[model samples]
Target: MCGIVGLYLKKPELEDQLGQLFSPMLIGMSERGPDSAGIALYGDPVADGRLKLTLQHPDMDYDWDGVKKALETQSGAAVSVDACDNHRTFDVQGDEETLSQWAEANLPGVTIMSLGQRIVILKEMGTPQEIVDRFDLTNVKGGHAVGHTRMATESAVTTAGSHPFSTGQDLCLVHNGSLSNHNRLREVIERRSSIRFQTENDTEVAAGYLTWKLREGMDLDSALEAALEDLDGFYTFAIGTADGFAALRDPIACKPAVLAETDDWVAMASEFRSLAHLPGVENAKVWEPEPAKIYTWGRAA
Candidate 1:
């Protein structure tokens, strides 16, 4: 089982509260996934320049050493790396062009999937405080976004197996449940594509499939609809992107994803308890999405 949560706020004041609210909420759902946790924030358009990247390793700080030099040299932005017990943290101050360009030219062998002034993604393979301390996450600001605590079922526990897997330049996905036909889908995608598969995990495979179809220029809506049709399994997914957010369960909507929505914000989790913070969010009016149904939340503007 995995935990997935998201918040889309219409009110700027409500949005300001998201970063503070997010870590705590994610902390609440830690039981759903313990292998790793992540958060992707999309601040309102027209904000200051800050894109932070955090990395953790047992004996070395590869994520910091490598990504920092790349961003500074390639993008002409100033970036710095800090050290936590097991991870290295850093922040880069630049525009979308600087961050996106550097990540692309430098962050090879990894998914530099999402990049934009509208989004900031931070995650780690431990508790929320671990993530915050190692990455200096709280300093990286944005209007709204997502974070995850992962449970590595079919994959090894590492940053590679974390959630909110970014697909498009502005879209990242977090999933629960298993895709029974992952082997076949992986084979099909590998044989007929330029996309590369990096890990043995089903989540990465899922991201690859989505990325492949999207590269063909298919919109996320149609690509996801096709993914639902072509891929068979018992799964629930939360996809976060710059333009908006989406979540869906399988044909039966078997895996649960309960949600709370107000004119100012939208939040969902594996259960109602995860969204209990909403003002009038009682035991009632909180429900899961219908089978095969896709629910989306996007930029308020």
Candidate 2:
């Protein structure tokens, strides 16, 4: 069992409270998933020509300044760093592929968590409250966020095995069930695209699949529709994108998920209790997401 929660704010005024509101929703699911916790926040887009790369290292006081200087000198990219706990968000005014390659070859202990104009992912092996406190999640401001708490039935409880896996820019997924065909799917994806799997976790495979589909020219909703036909397993998924949030359930719909919407926001969680404390939730329209249906909310919608 796992806990997944997402909140998408419809009003820009609420962006400042994103972290304060989202933290509790994540913590409420601690009983369902006490192994590890993660969250992907979307907002604060960099300039049109720039990208934000969030990187994680095991050391709380990693040598981020040295890394930044090396990156700027070698890659010729103007980089600004925002260090937070064990993670750092680099605003890069350069090529994403080149920067990623440089990091892979030079940064020995660093892991790229997420790369995009609007997404910053933070996760680690701990209770949801611990992660929140470590990252000071209550002070984070964003337009939307998706989080997960894992029970570790299939993989080790390492930070790399945590949910909210990012396989594409500004795209991440948190899952509530297992995929039976993940190994086969992983092989197919690796052989077909430039994307590579970073971990053995099935949720990573699912995220990679969606990334591949998006690269194939399908929009988010269509890609999710295709997922219903392609991905086999009993699962519930909450997908985070640069501009939107989405939820899906497999045909069996065995895993629990609830979606609630108010005039100002849209939220999804593995259980209603995760949504119980959100602002104005008492009057929000609430229901269980239907089996195999794609439900989406976003800035454009």
Candidate 3:
């Protein structure tokens, strides 16, 4: 079992408080998932032609500036690196594919967490509290965010096996429950698209499936509607994109999910406990997300 949480701010005035409000919601799931945790935050977008790549290395003291220099020299792109804990967000004015390829081939210990115009993903093998503290999540400002606290049953408890898997630009997915046909689905997606699986995690395959659907020109809601028919699983998914947040449950609705929306914001979690401490939750419209129903919020919708 795992815990998934998401928050989308409807008020621009609340953007600065996004992280402050989201921290407790994620930490509340520590009991449900003590193995690993991850978060995807949709913050201010970079320029239209630029993208941000959040990369992680095992060594906290790794020379990210040196890596930035190397990347700049190689790609001839004006790259800027922001270091936080063991992660670095590299803003690059270059092609995403080329930068990804260069990092894979040249940066030995670096792993690209997520690359997009508006999203930054940070994850590691630790409890939700530990991750939140380490990343200084309380200071992260964003319009929307989705997080996962993983209790690894389908894959080993490694950083790479953590949730909030990203298989597309500005998109990430966190899931509760397992996918029975993930192995077969993974093979099909790999053959059809340029996407590749990084670990033997079922959640990653679910993410890849969404990436494939979105690449096929389906909007977030349409893609999730199609997921009910194509993906076989007992799961609840909280998906975060550049400007949108969405939630979906399998047709059987075996995995638990709760959604609450106030006039100011919207939130979803694997359990309501995660939403209990949010501001104005008492007056929020709260309910269980129905089976196979796609719920979405944001400008992208």
Candidate 4:
């Protein structure tokens, strides 16, 4: 089992409190998943023609300053660094290909969590509260965010096995429950799509599947609908994208999921307690998400 929480702010006024509001929800679900935890936050977009790269080094004392200078020199792009614990986010002004080449040649032993315009994902092998504290998550400000606490069922308890796996640009997923046919599906995906997965976790495969579909021009809603048919499992997923937040449940609906929405925000979690502290939640429209259905909210919608 795992714990998943997501908050999508409809009111621009609450953007500044995105992390403040999300922190407790993640902590509330600590008992559900104590193995590892992570969060995907959608902050303001970087300047056009530039991309953001979120990286983490296992070494706590890694020299970020030297690495930053090296990246700037290698990519020939201005880079700004934001450090949190062992994690650093670099806003790099260059094309994706150039940055990829530079990273391959220069930044060995670093894990690239996510690369995109509006999303930053930070996760590690630690308790939910530890992750929150390590990243100063309580002070983070964003438009929307998705978080997860994982009790490992299939993979080893390591930073790489953590939840909120990212496959597409600005897209990530946090999942509860297991995918029974994941291994087979992983083979199928590897044979057909250009996408490559870096983890053995089923959640990562699910994220990659969605990335493949999105690359094929399917929108989030359609990609989820396809997932219901193609994937076999009892799972609840909270997916975050550059401009949208979505939740999906398998047809069995065996996993727990509750959604609460008000004029100001839309929130979902594995249980009601995770969302108990949101402002105006007492008056929110709360319900259990239907099985095999996709629920979505976006800035554009």
The whole-model lDDT of each prediction reads 0.68, 0.89, 0.89, 0.88
lDDT of 1 by residue, 1-301 (tens): 7878876665666655666656656766777877788777776543356654444345454455666677677657677654544544455676545554555565654444345445555556786567656655555545567767777777888776777676645577778887778888889998888666657778878888888898788887888899888878778887877755788788877777887777666777887666776555563356668888778876421
In model 2, which runs have C-alpha deviations exceeding 4 angstroms? none
Off by over 4 Å in 3: none
Candidates in order, TM-scores: namely 0.79, 0.97, 0.97, 0.95
Q: Would you list the rank order by lDDT, best first?
A: 2, 3, 4, 1
Candidate 4 per-residue lDDT over residues 94-137, each given as its tens digit: 76556655775677888778888988999988888988888889
lDDT computed for candidate 1:
0.68
Point out where model 1 deviates above 4 Å.
44-72, 75-114, 128-140, 280-285, 299-301
Clashes of each: 12, 0, 0, 0
Highest-scoring model, lDDT: 2
Per-residue lDDT over 203-288 for candidate 2, one digit per residue giving the tens place of the 0 to 100 score: 88899999899889988888888889888886899999888788999999999999999999999999999999998999999999
lDDT-superior candidate, 1 or 3: 3
Superposed Cα deviation of residue 266, candidate 4 (Å): 0.6
For model 2 the TM-score comes to: 0.97
RMSD (Cα, Å) for all candidates, in order, is: 4.2, 1.3, 1.2, 1.6
